[model samples]
Target: MQAVNISGFRPITTSVPRSAPYPSSARWRLPMKSSSDYGSCDFSCRQPLRISSSFSAAAAYTSADGETTLIQSSVGISDLLIVGPGVLGRIIADLWKKDYPGSQVAGQTLTTDHHDDLRQLGIHPISSGSNVEKFPNVIFCAPPSRSADYIADIRSAAACWSGEGSFLFTSSSAIYDCGENRPCDEDSPAIPLGRSRRTDVLLNAEGAVLEAGGCVLRLAGLYKFDRGAHTYWLSKGSDENRPDHLVNLIHYEDAASLSVAILKKNLRSRIFMGCDNHPLSRQEIMDYVNKSRKFDKTFDKFTGTDGPLGKKLDNSKTREEIGWEPKYKSFPFFLGVNTD
Candidate 1:
């Protein structure tokens, strides 16, 4: 990828290459965890970049020699649109609007259940039959369950988008087929699931976004505000299959803020693995959640199932590029927060 300049900031480019297909493997199970939870670009932000008030804003003062000085000017940008405004989408939309008041924010959803809610929040609802309009920023958070057609829709809209900033698509890290317990980055070999409709659809979606020169975020599991895979499992007494496998997670608020930061910064990294800095084994998480929540839910240990497929997702590059770090560092830490 080549480097380019945008608004005086250097942006790095990102690209994904085609790889030979691999045979299908057994579906990896969500290990029983205690219930832990958890950029570059020359683009202008929604508002002028402001330094901390504690710092003096003056560029410089004349010394013995009367020399004129200058302080760097901050940049700002335009509006945004979000496709598939689900839970995460809603949070993103709210945060985006909060950060960019008077910024035209549009939202597209498959249903109208939340139309009133979105309208109250000042997000303009977009219908499927509506004419395509481009904005300076765009985010696609559609699910793979919508099928490959969902991907096609994003590609079509992105192709016609008038924005020069960036397009970001949220994808799952399950694309990586790691069986051994090791960390995987954006360059790691992705898992190939032959004949699996869901896997095929998601992979195709990622390819479509990348091909469009847009950003593809491979996010780890998400948990926040009484919702999460671990919470569901604990409530259902789900079996603990992979006690040793590590689980990568990010808080809902953190994910939303991170995406906003990327767009505001107009970063160039095409592919990013989004996760918290810490990775915990299933057993450790389960114990922490069960103890913290006082649930004490028990899970059955496994023996013969090819030892559970596990992997660690690294998000250092993503953090470095975006210049944002997660507010919640680990699932346990998140749960321990005092709501009061």
Candidate 2:
């Protein structure tokens, strides 16, 4: 086997016996035989059939014919590369470290501005021009803001992925064209390309990931304690606020957990929705914020009644598939309101 350059990252080459007639791609679920199995039993590939070097210590069995079969014992989050380790990416990295101690977590940033901060959190930072290593588990959390061509960026990230692991792209739920406050799901129709520039870029990028057999997570509005839509609304004071327009939201922690779940599952070419399953209007959100008195500032009253309504996202199927439940169930719940 020879080293292959994918985008700018080069996969470390390991020689495999040419006499073995293995298929181009295959996956196997092998039983663990030792304590060093990384707590996972699944292994898969997408490129030319070859086991990952990480599995060098995998178990092997010899048949009567003297043929030896190597079984990959585990495929866990041992080595991870997070593209654009911003707020969400950093959270994911923290959780990864907590769950899998001693695992290496590297983050890629566009500049050296926050490299020190990443280092403080025990994350190795890869600057823009630095050589990227091919990671078995990769999660792309970079927004499309700075990219001249977001689709191309996604392609480059996809290329840097090792075929033996999972690659996930964090996309936005804004791609869905369900603006009339209609209920939306993973199967909802996306805003057609060319109609909206933002959606077009995201949709194209998502297409690139799916074509490469990666998973796509369309996340709803992400909010934390101090930063989010409510914070922005309170700061800027929108005069044209549409009080009736619904908005779907998810806490940052929940979103990070969902990302981790999807990566661990290693699903391919699948789209998953992430939301709190609680759709609240602008007025409703503000009402809860005011009632809680958690913030020093409060949002002004929203007077406007007519505008384009956001989608009501129902991720019941996603919850069932991923076996995840949000810690902060809704905005009101987070604000200590008994919505039940």
Candidate 3:
């Protein structure tokens, strides 16, 4: 077979074999195989037909101006294991299972606090000694709470990995808290988390993943579905007295979707900043929520400038590279606020 670009539906110049009796415009279906077996998997195509949801790889070629549509479709891994699967991790695992039914999903938690809850969600609890070979796709979602031991924890988990597929680590955008009141992207410089030591630990863990050819996603403040800090404050009627500091956020669902998108696209060894397109201020979000939800939250008559204005995030690289866009563009969309 001829080499084809499967990432996007771009036109390609290739000839079919003489033995194959098919027109140029015919749709050709290919079975899933390893990246070594096939030329390369296209991780950018959307709206693809569900050929075989099996963990084994599969691809489909639609004949239209020689466009090749090759979606990795679950990375061909039969199982996935999430380390320290908190809220975001659970969301990713659930979305992954929903998108690819054939894959087995499990989670590893240090404490038993969420074991029963995870089991109810159909995610089996796994330990460090669990066969990493069986679950080649591993995601590290542990936060910096244990900053002192984060590096060792990730390294230990990574050491157990069989190196069959991609490993993704969830990092926080606080790493970029350079105190700059401007917009930043993945290439921007970040201030050292001096004295705090938490940022250093997180950075160390990210470095380890990068060294291992894994992926690191720096996420913004997560909200929606009764889990936003802003929402908590709003419910308490506390938004009226706060300053309008800039804030970036990604809806829980969008974050989950993006994680699964990265995996299906076979992305690795890169840092992706996960945030929605809009960056609203505290007062703006509060006002919108109050007006839309009729919360009747009280605000202070005086606006106090206590801290530096927050930074905005640019997500153009993620959108262009992954061919994925957040279903919720901004907080307004999440809150169902009327744009008109």
Candidate 4:
């Protein structure tokens, strides 16, 4: 056995003789809690469990001479291909590696601009139009803005999958037509295709993935310390903000964890929602930020109130079905404002 240098981690590798036949099944499972225990367990509190499984499956590579070669590799949900590995995708990759150190993670980007940075994070970078191997597990995190045709891009990514594992598409909660601050869930009706262009794109993309037996994760407004709705509000300092409009949010890390959990579960043709389970008005968010004094800049008081009030998203069903919970329970929780 030889060690392969993957960023800071060294995953063991072994060379197999060409004469040996490839193994048929190479499935590996991560240590997961029972459905009842998952709700009580905190994903952040657990240590990364080491996998004792070895790669027995072979990958086929064709040479210039048209000679086919078999290469033995490790088996698990560990072999992941993330299409459009941006902020949320990167977090998901890092967290996935933390849990399964032997995992082989690759990210597909439009250009080679972030290739080096991705390598530094132990993720192999694959540029668009480049030849790549089929991955057992695939997640499409690319937004519609990145492509002229979002549905085609998603279908193409699905075609690249091995179909032996899970395929997940990250959709948006905005697709839900709950504009009156009504509670929305996985069963909530989405905006019909012709209604809103933005939501229509997402809804069409979700339909494509679902038609292909893939999972769809409709995520809420994603935020982190310096880049969430709060930061944007403080920077704008505008009076045109809608104070009464509600917003649901999820921390980037929590979204990432929930993604990995769903992928590990390997559910197909299912729709899941991700949110911090806290819906606050724009005014409420700003007020909390100002009172906490987390930032130096103070947001201007919102004066205008004539915009669509955002929906209140409830992912309780999502939590129970996936057996996962958001580590950052709410925006206030992430801000260190103890609600309890």
Task: Look at candidate 1 and tell me the lDDT of residue 102.
Answer: 53
Question: Which whole-number lDDT from 0 to 100 does residue 264 have in model 3?
Answer: 64
lDDT of 4 by residue, 63-177 (tens): 3333333333343446788999999999999998898887778787776677788878888676655444556788999988879767667766766665667889988888776
Between candidates 3 and 4, which one is better according to TM-score? 4
Q: What is the TM-score of each candidate against the true structure?
A: 0.72, 0.78, 0.72, 0.78
lDDT against true structure, model 1: 0.60
- Candidate 3, residue 265: Cα displacement in angstroms equals 2.6
Q: For each of the candidates, give the backbone clash count.
A: 7, 0, 6, 1
lDDT against the true structure, each candidate: 0.60, 0.70, 0.61, 0.70
Q: If both were scored by lDDT, which would come out higher, candidate 1 or candidate 2?
A: 2
User: Candidate 4: where is the Cα deviation over 4 Å?
Assistant: 1-77
Candidate 2 lDDT, tens digit per residue, 1-340?
1111233211111222222111111111122112111121111112322443343344443333333333333333367778899999999999988877766687776666787798789887765444334567888999989976566566666666764567889999997778788888866667665576676667667656665667788999999989898998877655476798898999999999999988888776677889999999888888788888888887778777676878899988788888999999999999897665
Q: Which 10 residues in a row give candidate 4 its minimum summed lDDT?
A: 20-29
TM-score of 2: 0.78
Cα misplacement distance, residue 14 of candidate 1 (Å): 22
Name the regions of candidate 1 deviating beyond 4 angstroms.
1-77, 193-196, 294-307, 337-340
Candidate 1 residue lDDT tens string, 184-222:
775676765354455566666655555455667778888
